[model samples]
Target chain A: MALKLYLDRMSQPSRAILTFCKVNGIEFEEVKIELAKLQNYSPEYAEVNPMKQVPAIVHGEFKLFESHAILIYLASAFSGVADHWYPADLQKRAKIHSVLDWHHSNLRRGSATYIFNTTIALAFGQPLNLEAAAEGEKILIASLAKIESFWLQDDGPFLLGNSQPSIADLSMACEVMQLEVVDTKDRDRILGPRKRILKWVEDTKNATAPYFEEIHSIIYPAKEKLQKLKTMAAKKEPQSTGEPA
Target chain B: MALKLYLDRMSQPSRAILTFCKVNGIEFEEVKIELAKLQNYSPEYAEVNPMKQVPAIVHGEFKLFESHAILIYLASAFSGVADHWYPADLQKRAKIHSVLDWHHSNLRRGSATYIFNTTIALAFGQPLNLEAAAEGEKILIASLAKIESFWLQDDGPFLLGNSQPSIADLSMACEVMQLEVVDTKDRDRILGPRKRILKWVEDTKNATAPYFEEIHSIIYPAKEKLQKLKTMAAKKEPQSTGEPA
Candidate 1:
């Protein structure tokens, strides 16, 4: 039986996994969820993933969530890939693992917050705060700097210096691509300070060319929604009930 | 060379990794850091891990973080243990991966809030609010319920139902043990009557055999300090603050 993937193009991990399958010639059924409306909230999807998050997979009787896991599973189980995506070497694999783990709390959180504050909060009719926005951006920049200087630089054109993409490279590129959707002009400016990183992201995009097709349509709607979100956010500064931390 | 671990036991992942090493009879160095004292904030530690989180390992200069990644790396690299710990079979491995990913947002955040609110808040003399306390309990029970009904069902005493525990069981057991330190005896009222859940928790602890040692000594002080933190909580209630979540 073929694998079943539950995804939304706007979701970074989903795009990454879809692209991986497409590029590798792996067979899977793609089920789309309307992330904008939180269609993931429906009872149907909930049975598959209790967390109601995207980038989940159902393979036969088994189920799995978390894009990183799904990425590894696809690469390992399918035929058209190389071992470099998730290396067999112990320490090398550990390095890849470390970055993926760090990516979750650091860059991944930053990307989600920036886009959500810029986009989803508007769709949800929630408020966004500039102070919080500025704070998140600061985190985003520091994190991006680490990705560039610490991991990608030593490897040359790709993360882990593959000259080919690894799961870390693929997973992260999808996240950085969220920033791309926010506003390519602003995205490059943010990425501008990191010379090698800016180049590496471009490299990852080309390597995962199939993603360009899956992701393009989602960009315009996302940006328009995000603009409306900005106005709603300006209106929201006063209602925060959180105690001063 | 023996494997070396750099950990702060205050962090549950570190404890989980340590427990895995001990259970496997893996000889390794235990290099401790005092998280309460803010020792991880040092610039030097930042060199090893840019994010500066604990439970990182330095095995012959192949430093790694992200407990799940470390778990897989150790299980794969060492090859000393049963395949069930991180099965070569894709389905079993995927199940473990799913739980590890779940652990990130679920265990990491919930446990941190509980431990921080009750212990760190006490140590720092910050206020802990009722709303926050309830929130923490909500997260813990929610996470525990998922572990019990989903992973620890009849066919399996362990996550995979083996003669011995797998890495999945150990990773989760570490977080569950945190309940001893930050266990809210009163949570049964707020999260609603989960008699089956409460009973399941006891069954889980009993099945594990060596439960208290998993959580003792470290949280004992934190538990002792909760009372004074309550006094601090009362004073700060006007402003809203208190012990660990």
Candidate 2:
């Protein structure tokens, strides 16, 4: 039986896993769990992932959640994939693991918070929580600084000094790419200062090539919708109920 | 040269790594980073880990941070250790990785927040943030429920159903054990509703044996101190400065 992957394109981890499968030529069924429609909360999907999160895979009867785990599993189970994506060398592999683990609490958390406070809140027509956005920016800045000075400090382009990109690179680059949904000013202020991080993100995108672009195609429409919503909000008259729509 | 491990026994991940090394008989020089003393912020220690977090290891010349990564590294780099702690079988290892990756934002985050709001705040003679503690309790409750219903639903004693416990078990057990510092009322309200989780924690402690108890011995004093501080605050007259101290 072929592997099964449940994902929503809008999610960073989902894109990371989808790109991995596409780049590696791993055949799998992509089951879309649309976040906007709250499809993940459905009973059937929850069975596959009780956490109701995207980027879960079912390989035969073995089901796995957590994108990094799925990535590592795919790399280990499949034969003939490029070894650099998740190296077999003990030290190199461990370093990749280190970055992936550190990511959950740092980069991923910061990026998700920043996007939620700025972009998602606007999309939903909710008032921006400036305090929360400020906090998220703080975390995002600190996380980016750590990535530049620590993870990307090595001479090579990829994390852990690899000539080829690894799963850690894919996971983190996808996370930073999420900032695309925010307005130009907020996005620039948060991500603009980091030159090395920008280059590394570009390098990772190049390494993944067409699949990266293909999987991330949905971001355009999403960004467009957010822009339209912002413009509409600015021109709207004050309503009796104080609601935008 | 012996491997160097930078850890503060008070931290959960640090305890997890320390116990792993002790159980496996991996010779390591324990470099204590006294978190309370702000030693982790020192210029010297920041070079070891720019994040300034405990549970970093220097194996030979290679430096690694993040306890999960260090655990995986130690499991792979060393020989003669029990395989079940970090199984080499592809499916089994992937499942362990899945649990470890899911753990960070869910279990560890909630548990740390609960401990900090209730116990650590008291220890510092700071007024408890009731709102944050309530929020942390909600997360902790949901997390514990997930552990029982999803992860512990397996028929076997351990997380992945092996007779022996895996590193996931150690990391999670340590996280839950942190609630020991909270007063009984708050702790019971948060943890007492869960039966299976308690049993699983006890089973994990038994499986890890003397090493788990030995490493966690410091918690007793800390818990006692927090209790005494709470009692002292309750009995004292209102302070002139409008603070507990």
Q: What DockQ, between 0 and 1, does each candidate earn?
A: 0.52, 0.81
lDDT by residue (tens digit), candidate 1, B1-245: 55888788766778778766765567789888677677777897887666677877777767787887888888877757667667888877777777776776675557656656654565555555555555565777677666656655676456644444667667776666555554365433423464544444444445444642564457667665665666566676553543223
Tell me the tens digit of each residue's lDDT in model 1 across A48-161.
887788989988877888898888787777776887777777787777877787787778867676666544566666654444455467778888888766777564588756
Model 1: runs farther than 4 Å from truth?
A: A129-135, A181-192, A213-217, A228-245, B42-47, B122-141, B159-164, B183-215, B225-245
User: Would you give me the overall lDDT of model 2?
Assistant: 0.84
Best by DockQ: 2
State the weakest 10-residue window (summed lDDT) of model 2 chain B.
B236-245
Give, for candidate 2 chain A, the lowest lDDT window spanning 10 residues. Answer: A236-245
